[model samples]
Target: MPPSVRRSVEQRADSVGFIAVKRAANAIAEAARDSNSVRLSGAEHTAAYLLTRMPATYAASCKVLDELRGVPVASVLDIGAGGGSAALAAHEKFPLAREITLVERDPLLAEAAREWLPAAHILAGDLRRMTTFPPHDLVIAAWSLGDLPAATVARLWEAARVALVVIEPGTLRGAAFVRKVREELLAAGAHMAAPCPAAMPCPMVEPDWCYFAARVELSSMQRRIQGGDLSYQDERFSYVALVRDPVGLPRARILRRPRHHPGLIELDVCTAQGRRSERATKRRDRDAFRAARHAEWGGAV
Candidate 1:
């Protein structure tokens, strides 16, 4: 996480000083074990969530925003904005955005959002009941779609006037949800914007899923609460960017980290045609090999 964001989270955690960090950590662990349980009810658990999960979520959201490099975003609506991490990320990415709205159901989480995101328009309502949403240039649902029904997801996509970005955990199940949502958005006439070369159809199948990882440095308080020896963590996430207007597409997206050898580079790429493994040897293709050498996991080749 960036120093600014880390400081913001730390300040919020400090405000909720009555709760013990250990209890909040334990609550977060218990909630993680059971997906169907209601977790963000009290201030302590909300604070714990800010301390433990907010940084990684913010990092992943920022990664998604980075994909929209040249696109203009003047307004943003973040659905299921727990702790307002997505809103914060959007503000950092597009500082010119005149309006940012955050919709969350839990009262405690909503309260925390008010403290963290004073500039955003916080709408306290259940997503299932939200029949109509306000218009915005960008609509984001980060780590929020898995809990929603397919109909609701489609509705949210329909509300996007410019673009829609959905993010989920990098687990297999999360990838499945992202794939399903991608299909729904495509059916709704949205165009692929990132991490995909085309909008034809997902070429991936079972035992293989599309995902990316973002690295976040853990705060001292976070390390103490989670009892971790490492000073940083990698947050794996699956995301898709859909736009109303057509944009330039990459020829192929590197799905995995490039493999380097003595004089060769291997890249696992997904293109509009299909998934394939391509090799670039220094002797055969000097330029291609140089490009592959610097390519990261999610970059276009």
Candidate 2:
């Protein structure tokens, strides 16, 4: 998370007491474990999300949007913009973006987003009921499409002039939603942009799902509220990026972190053909070995 955003979150946490935030955090976590969307109604729940959830979500958004660095993005629209995490990440990634709009169903969250992003147009409306959205170069539905109807979700793609990104939890249910969106959009003429090497059926099967993790450094207040000993957490997320134009697609995408040992490197990557494992050794392929040794999860290989 950016420094400016971090400070803003911390300030919000301080306003809410630790006990109330902790209780709300536990409730929110339980809701997620049950694969249920939480409707945060109180200040405690809102603050809990701002402290315990927003940072990790922002980190994941940053990682996902970084892949689209070369894509031209003049404007961004964030659906289900909880505390504006995705919008903040987009603003940081695409500095050239002139217009940034965020749609949040929760009025508190929308007001909180305005505090962080004063120049942005934060709209308070339920995305499910909205029939149409203004077109933008980039449309983001991060952690917001889970409960949306298929038809409503389709409208998000329609609003994207250049690209659309949908993100969900790393759970099996979340991956299922992402897969459904990927298939539907691809059939509608959208092309795979990131994390997918080709516009083909997902190679992952029932037991395995496509997901990535982003390490987020927690603030002191965040650690206290969550009751964790560690200073960081890995935010796991599943996402699909679709673009109107297919350009600069990679030959393969690393699905997991590379394993290195005894001068050998192993990469589990998704290729155009299917999911496969690649092995590289110093003696056999020095260049490939070097690249694999430094490769990260969710990177192009």
Q: Residues 201-226, candidate 1, lDDT per residue (tens digit)?
A: 88888898999888888888877776
Q: Which candidate achieves the best TM-score against the true structure?
A: 2
* Model 2 per-residue lDDT at 237: 94
lDDT of 2 at 1: 71
Error of 2 at 242 (Å): 0.5
Superposed by TM-score, candidate 2 places the C-alpha of residue 32 at a distance from the truth, in angstroms, of: 1.5
TM for candidate 1 is: 0.93
Residue 87 lDDT in model 1?
86
Clashes of each: 0, 0
Report the C-alpha lDDT of model 2 over 94-143, residue by residue, as the tens digit: 99998999999898888889988899997788887899998999999889
Tell me which residue pairs clash in candidate 2.
Answer: none
Candidate 2 local accuracy as lDDT? 0.89
